[model samples]
Target: MGTISPIKESTCCDPASAGTVYLPSGTSLILLMPRLLATTIHGAVDVLKKTFDGTYDDNCPACGETHAHGGICCGIPEIHCPSPCVCSIHWVGCPGDSFKHAIQVTNTSKTEREFTLTSVPFPHTQEAVAVTPGKQTLGTEESLQAEASFTIPETFAGSKYRTVIKVKGAYEQIIQVCLTVRPRQACGCHVEQGDIPKRVKAHHWYHHFQCVEDCFEPAKKVG
Candidate 1:
């Protein structure tokens, strides 16, 4: 018998020599596919739920209403005030009562800054709203407590008043102040007797009466 030649071993190229070899085998890919698919489906479901659930920031807290995309809450314009600024303040008091609140101001910048606080009264109303510490200087990252006070006039019973307190510095801030003057005496009816329109047209009488009755029901408890 002829002697068999020694078998030559074949040499394979190194994976690094081939440049950027993907080592995952078909079985590895199959194992990973289900995990990738499940992850994608979970992300999609989350997006859909948030879109339809009205959990976005534009929903109004006061009215439980949602506005169009990028719209402000309750359709109110966005207040371009600083984070420390108090955007709104509300108070309810009987006539001749005084109310006070504290507004916090901060110097958000790196350097010292001066600020001025001014109260702008609503047109045609003599609401006695005042902001103290009208002018102040704050150091870097320092904060100040400003006072806002209002005294309801004796003649201002059963009325609503609004005033704006403005803070001017490196930037401007606005605080809306609202005062509700409670009636001294009850109207004796569920609906406020004074608010009823005396001479409504026959066709519109029902609507007018209904509106007055529904709107004034809460006022009965104020006194």
Candidate 2:
């Protein structure tokens, strides 16, 4: 145990000393602020791993497509760890005519804390499907571990998916985890920089007409 260095003028302890000083559960409420640590600790490498060696035994082989191809269903997006690890979706081969897929997230926070996950697709979402438990009291036990999981969706109708993890610790520091998704299906119609509109203004009349007349011109820009 470490003693908090005292401050002047006030009898109360400093906010920076909160992490070291023991506090009751829920007493250590973290204010989600931009930055509290004046001395920024470079984020650790985020990592993701799956222990699904035998989770799904009957599901068919995962569709290789990145996006929905009509009848096939894909796993959800996931993220993990702040450093020393990479997060993404993974597919594993299973027994005859079966396989498993998962979104693995990992954290590299040296300090133990609570983690919450949410997404725009499920805006009203509230709850922590995954989290790392804190350590036991001093002279007791010090555990080192992190937690997260694959959040299943109700439907696969979304064009894309994204999720975020908000980590709040006794130190009052907050971190974010952003997970991005990609569709499996390839674009039937190629898009080029020229095809994209800018400034949100009306495009040239002649250019718009020419595009309808000779759409091939735009395709050239794609290549």
Candidate 3:
């Protein structure tokens, strides 16, 4: 083997000077953020790879450390990229008419965010549901009040339905709403009382009235 050259002595003689650095375990901590780089390198070409990946010297102020791809053995802080809004609702709607309900979406972030509202009725039911202002954009600290409406079919009964509202921006979030529909019998003689419109008479029936014998009787024939 050829004679080894004398090692250079410098102010910083740590292994890091040879192009490799050792970061103690737990020294790197990432909190409340998503990783910009899905992978990291620890080989001879680590520096070259980081430069090519465009993640060099991108230090997070929260943790005061460069990203893993930036040559710091210590863990890099999460991107902590700001979100467009803070959602206010999880499950909306209570036991009531499935035809309509109120909704609220708020944008609490410092920037603008885009959102969309959609619905999925119970597969077995014939009702069609929809959300008003389905798609919209909100600015910082802005909010929107939307309505969800259901169009009940002829044979609908008391049932529950669900709708999924998705908010997409820096990240994606899903919101769910449960809707309750009352049975047609809930009208309770509204048809006879004229409380309901004449056009809608055939669509609804009173539960008590249905159990009774037919109101009309056939006339007897004369000899």
Candidate 4:
């Protein structure tokens, strides 16, 4: 008859939230682990809070509040900056005179705060969208303005020009200005000293230029 012997068994385990940790079962170590350790929330919730954050019905309600500022990421009482506002496009003109447009960037914060405008998508030449005055500081009940202008050239006498105006730091706001130049027909070759010229020249040139070297010759022979 074979003798029965006690078999050696391995240790046991209880999962943890942040990461896996070996704890001696039935000891004080089991009580110390957080309740959410085994769940997916333990491994990813903190990472979600760290990058590419946004707010809608249950998130921060403002811009730049997620990355720059710290907040608790929960299902309720969404996180966001205290103040939120936006700049927008107001007007666009067609070929009429010159390109011109304006904008008003406001501060919605009730408390005093400072902001520095750093733009990558500017309205001109695909350059860094930057504030005209540079390193601006706005307080409560304050605003900023910007404008664009372009003169009409003689060649494009009746042509239109478009000017894009975008606010710095505020990516959403954009404006396009249209300046229409009145039409100016070319000088009348027929008119001489402010007199009827093209009226008479066009008449002769149309047929005269077409007839070429033999224009008057053929008429002379017929006459």
On TM-score, the leading prediction is 1
TM per model?
A: 0.45, 0.23, 0.36, 0.29
- 45-94 per-residue lDDT for model 2 (tens digits): 11111113332233445743343223445566466545522343332211
Global lDDT scores for all candidate models: 0.76, 0.36, 0.57, 0.44
User: What TM-score does model 1 achieve against the real structure?
Assistant: 0.45
Q: CA shift at 103, candidate 3, in angstroms?
A: 1.9
* Tens digits of lDDT, candidate 1, 8-88: 999997777777656888898888989899999999999888777655446565645576544555544555644745689
Compared with the true structure, what per-residue lDDT tens digits does model 3 show for residues 45-79?
68787677855766656466665443545664366
* Best-to-worst ranking by lDDT: 1, 3, 4, 2
Candidate 2 — which residues are off by over 4 angstroms?
Answer: 1-122, 126-129, 132-143, 154-164, 183-223
Candidate 3, residue 145: lDDT: 82
Model 4 regions lying over 4 Å from their true place: 1-102, 110-135, 186-223
Task: Please tell me which model should have the higher lDDT, number 2 or number 4.
Answer: 4
**How much RMSD separates candidate 1 from the native structure?**
20.1
Q: In model 3, where do residues sit more than 4 Å from their true spots?
A: 1-98, 124-127, 182-223
Q: 113 in model 3: Cα distance from truth in Å?
A: 1.9
